[model samples]
Target: MEIAEILDFTVPLSSITLERVVLAILVAIIGWIVVKVLTSTFTTALSRASNLPGLVVEFLARFFSVLLYVILALIVLAALGVDISSMVLGLSAVIGLILGFGLQDSINNLAAGVWLAAFRPIDKDEFVEVKGISGKVVSVGILATELLKPDNTYITIPNSLVWGNPVINSSRMETRRVEVKVGVAYDSDLDTAIRVATDLAAAHEKVLPSPKPAVVVTELGDSSVVLALRAWTKTSDVGGVQGDLNRGILRAFREAGIEIPFPQLDVHLTGAE
Candidate 1:
């Protein structure tokens, strides 16, 4: 049996000459290059000319690339003397069935992607927490959203899950509040402790002056007086400022002779039964 007979091609085996094979190879190469150039140009044009969100622009570029490649494939098949009309119809039917059943989750993800792109809840480079995962948004694609975690790991979440869950955007605000809780001995002077904490926060360069760093007595515990130090700083400086405050407060408390209390247990025993 000939090659054509195995694949049920309408074209006869004799027609599958070396020249046709070379032509097919040449067409594929050229088509691939053309597709690359077209997609690149289309992406650049959309980015420059339109106000669409970056994710939406990416989605459009991918869609256009897929469409062009499909067309290129059909042209290549035609060059091979294959009947394309029936093949296209058959492919359409198969695709329809796949979309209807096998790709339901994919369809939902795509829809969620569209919603995400349109609403602009999260954008590239923004720090966010969604579904208990915290990371910086890398790219939002048609099916999934990519995130770059703080520890240099990458995570990909399906758009459906991302859309269904609440998103916490930490980078949306210009500044963030940093709170550090400290406990002092019950016998320590509360006024002096508060003053030391307030001074420590105010001395930090990152801490905002307008809000004014404050130390408030939060709780009277079993072994200590709990005080909370609150300060505001630029969002990007939150971690650094918080660390500095913690270290500074510890050192300052020691120097000021204020005691940081720890939990203790007191027991009484009867001498006689």
Candidate 2:
């Protein structure tokens, strides 16, 4: 056989089309497997490192694995004579324009989600008060926040809203003030009333001793003198302790022969002012 004839005839017989197809398939499968294995390994290491939830680590692993596989697929397609870079740039521009026009709010929410996940301004199961809404965080999803309120109501706050405003966490402080005011007759001794209110506040089980409870004379009303009792308690126990202390103070004052004054108006029977 002549060299020229052999070269020309065998090239067509090699079946380059099927070879390319099989190679592409093999690349995709192998790339997927490598991505998953590598991601799993990293997840396992991170899971063992701290007290984070296993599901969180696993979720992060799968998410990153998908990202890695996308990059790998782009590279593979480029090697296979596809115009990957230009296509990716064009797609990105189109996506950007679409997001700017119709999906701005959704994109803002997604960006907020990423920021929250990375920075951890709040965590799962934490009791948080944001924008006058107070609740325990049930879940921090990719697009929205799920909150379980104390009254058993479910609240779904968008991630953008969560990140956009300033959050005040009443439960975040070490100690909180449990405050109440009581009115007593003008005839009652101010010093005795202060003593009684202070003693009552101090006797509560949840009240802290270091700061010490105090009674402040706030207002002199027509019917009574208002005494304010300010006591400190652990942030978590504020609500319960407040209720208990208020009830106890009232009962204690009653036992001490203190009169709880009510509003009274002396009727002057004059025709007109």
RMSD of candidate 2 to the truth, in angstroms, is: 7.4
Q: Candidates' TM-scores?
A: 0.84, 0.69
Model 1 misplaced regions, further than 4 Å: 1-20, 267-272
Superposition error at 64 for model 2 (Å): 4.0
> Model 1, 130: alpha-carbon shift in Å?
1.9
Superposed by TM-score, candidate 2 places the C-alpha of residue 9 at a distance from the truth, in angstroms, of: 28
**lDDT, candidate 1, residue 92?**
92
Candidate 2 at residue 199, lDDT? 87
Highest TM-score: give the candidate number: 1
Most accurate candidate by lDDT: 1
> Backbone clash tally for model 2?
0
The true-versus-predicted C-alpha distance at residue 215 of model 1, in Å, is 2.5
Off by over 4 Å in 2: 1-44, 50-90, 264-269
Q: Write down the lDDT that model 2 would get.
A: 0.79
